[model samples]
Target: MIALLLALGSSLAYGCADFLGGLGARKAHVLRTVMVAAPASLAIELLLWPVLGASFDPGAIGWGAASGVASAVAFALLYKTLALGPMNVLSPVTALVSAALPVGVGLIQGERLGTAGLLGLPLALIAVVLVSAGHGAGSSRPSRTALLLAFGAGAAIALQLVFLHQAPADSGVAPLIVGRAVSTAVTLTAAGVLRRRLGREKPAYAMSAAAGVLDSVANLLFLIAVRSGDLTVVAVITALYPVGTVLLARSVLAERIHRGQLVGLGTAAVAVSLLALTST
Candidate 1:
């Protein structure tokens, strides 16, 4: 029960960060946002380390680094897709795919579902769709390339979860910290190259750094949640981050929620209930 709550909290934080990062990227550069966010995340991690009393194994470091790379790629692509495609189409598609992979992997690894959990599956799907639904009632056409990139991002996200889950529990928070560092480095390097080509660097660099900090913190919370609970349940709850994204969009971006989104929210509530019931 406690783990599930932590996972849910992580999801909310992550969703807000993603939404804000996306907005920040639009106002600046994707790489820039990542660079800024990374260090902020690292600082938070460092601060929490003593309290968490987390330690890491060498193998955990490797896996964390790999997850970091995957995360960097995923966010880069996700932001790029958001820039090019409609939020309604891109967010849901990416989120659904991302959630599905871990669930599928868990099943393959022999994670069993109770009756409530089995029923919750569809609700989870509906919740994702609902939470990601946009207010663009008239926008129908979406770019194929953007959709493909979103799918790629989703795949990367799934891989991130898989690697995180595989990290040894005794490895403590080392994997997560290392993963954030690697992700931050990779994103900054990529941003540097892009900025050099475009002849613009300052603001972009700053933004990426800020975004990187938020990303790192979010990852740490997720790691803590996973360490304490079932990975499948934690992953699913965390993946429901779109709910936070939608709420933020409504407030900060003044974006309107459609009827579908309301339905989605309701469905998500049901899904959460189901997940809670099943986790027991």
Candidate 2:
């Protein structure tokens, strides 16, 4: 139950981070926005190390580095895929795949679930797709390349989460620190490579930094949650982050909540409730 709560907290943090990051990206190139965000994330992780304690064990360093690479891949592919247009099709697909892979991995690792959890898991996945639904389906489908990139981005995100989970328990926040460092380096490199194309628009440094801080918090919460709970449950609940993003959009941007999204929000509530009951 504590794990579920922590996972829910992580989901909310992730959602808020996405909302802020999206706002930052609107003001500058994605890579430029990430340039601010990534280093900010690393700074937060560094700050956390003293409070949380960390070990430099091989499992921690290796898995952390792997997750960092996966994260960099996810960031690049997701932005590229979204740039191709028809985000309505691609966003939900990415979210579903991101959530589904971890669930599948968890189950394959022999994690058992209660009957309620069994039912809730699939419902949670459905909610992920629904909540991530955009205002419209657009006039046409995403291109095959866009679809492939979305899948790749989702897979990379799943790998990041799975790798983080595979880190040694006693490693504490070491994996997060190492992962953030690597991702920060990757973001800086990408931004440097694309400097000519990034334009001269000033990035939303504050919002981007805020996003990074919240994202680091989300990752920390997820790591703690997964350490103490079933990965299947933790991953599914965390994937509900779109709920937070949608709500933030509606509140901050005065965006309308589509029927599909409304239904999805309700479905997510039910799924969380069922999972909660099972957790107890």
lDDT of each: 0.78, 0.92
Candidate 1, residue 277: the lDDT equals 91
| TM-score, one value per model | 0.90, 0.98
lDDT of 2 by residue, 141-176 (tens): 888999999999899999999999999999999999
Put down candidate 1 lDDT per residue, 175-203, tens digits, no spaces.
88788788878877886777755335344
Query: Model 2, 124: alpha-carbon shift in Å?
Result: 0.5
Model 1: runs farther than 4 Å from truth? 136-138, 197-213
In model 2, which regions exceed 4 Å deviation? none
Q: Candidate 2: which pairs clash?
A: none
